[model samples]
Target: MTSEIQSYNFNGASLRTLTDGAGEPWFVAKDACDILGMSNPSMAVTALDKDEVAQIDPKDYLGSENRSNQAVNIVSEPGLYKLIMRSRKPEAKEFQRWVTHEVLPQIRKTGGYIPTSESDSDEDIMARAVL
Candidate 1:
């Protein structure tokens, strides 16, 4: 019904992750950029291939204060992998391995994503984002 965020730690990076009801994974673009050693995610996403952008979208997330955090462009599974593939970080391969061999498969098996509380429900978050 709404977007969700699941903060996952990889090595030392804190990745803001997401999964829809269909178990498709997405990541907060800025967080992804930060993890991959980029300075500007907004500019970076613009440089992505058009086909890549087609699968991604920009959405606002509700932060701990229960208010709309800055809008973070969200990337879909393909975009996540593409960003990883384009990265030269030593952990790129390791990140891919974890997400593919572990996180993704686990989500697929589970079938849905659940956020922490009613404050994070899609409608609630979307409402805050709109405000």
Candidate 2:
């Protein structure tokens, strides 16, 4: 299967990503794990739900015949969030915000998401006040 992988930078770290047939984004597990300060990518991936993980050949996306046949691990959005929550690093929250507010919107902008009204409601005001 052919796939296009996109790369996003967070605090100078690269998070390589790709979308599935349904247009849902999947993040490179090693990249995310490294950003989140996880020592072992494979071990961290095992903690996520089976449905929240997948394997893909880098050759398919990179189009490099010289690349090895070893499949790379990827995580769904939910799985990424789970890893973020597990992280003890101080910058984890900032990374999460970047992913949600910036990266995801751009990725889904092609077809899947439709934004709601920009008008601020009472709840929005209250939430902002609390922050």
Task: Report clashes for each candidate as comma-separated counts.
Answer: 0, 0
Q: Highest TM-score: which candidate?
A: 2
Candidate 1 residue-wise lDDT, 10-81, digit = tens = 777787766666766666777788877767788878867664543333333434523443455767768777
lDDT per residue as tens, model 2, 1-131: 23877776777898887888887789889899888888899999999999999898777774662266788889998999899888888767787776678657855775333222359786875564455
TM-score for each candidate, following the candidate numbering: 0.57, 0.68
Give the Cα-based TM-score of candidate 1 against the true structure.
Answer: 0.57
Clashing pairs in 2: none
Q: Highest lDDT: which candidate?
A: 2
**lDDT accuracy of residue 105 in candidate 2:** 82
